[model samples]
Target: MDVRISKRRTTGQMSVFELDALREAFRRSVRENNVTEVQWAEHAERFVKSMIRKESRGIQA
Candidate 1:
């Protein structure tokens, strides 16, 4: 699977540590499922959005 991180406008920038964590999460997802590329992308997008929302709300994600 090709895992690419696109540069886009977000509520805030993620630190290197956060990005690494996200990458690991994606890898775990891949390991647990046989998802298509599109599905993987969607999953990643949702995860990122949730993270941003949680941060904005001052909650742990």
Candidate 2:
């Protein structure tokens, strides 16, 4: 946890928001067994993108 380390996502790695999406997807999978792969993927994508958007909006000089 060094301040100098870059926060940017590395290639082939998941971001914190994406990881959270996975966690949510897993839970939804268990609860909604009928969910399709396409639907699940969209959910994860939306979750991560929305969180990133929200986080970026909070940044200020």
Model 1 global lDDT (CA atoms, 0 to 1): 0.67
* Per-residue alpha-carbon lDDT of candidate 1 for residues 1-61, written as tens digits (9 for 90 to 100): 2122223233345568878987897788767776677697787787679766876585332
Q: What lDDT does candidate 2 reach at residue 43?
A: 61
Model 2, TM vs. native: 0.40
Cα deviation of 30 in candidate 1 (Å)? Answer: 5.1
Assess each prediction's global lDDT (C-alpha) against the native: 0.67, 0.62
TM-score of every candidate relative to the true structure: 0.48, 0.40
Q: Model 1 Cα displacement at 53 (Å)?
A: 0.5
Q: Predict model 2's lDDT versus the native.
A: 0.62
Q: How many clashes does the backbone of model 1 have?
A: 0
Clashes of each: 0, 0
For this target, which candidate reaches the highest lDDT against the unseen true structure?
Answer: 1
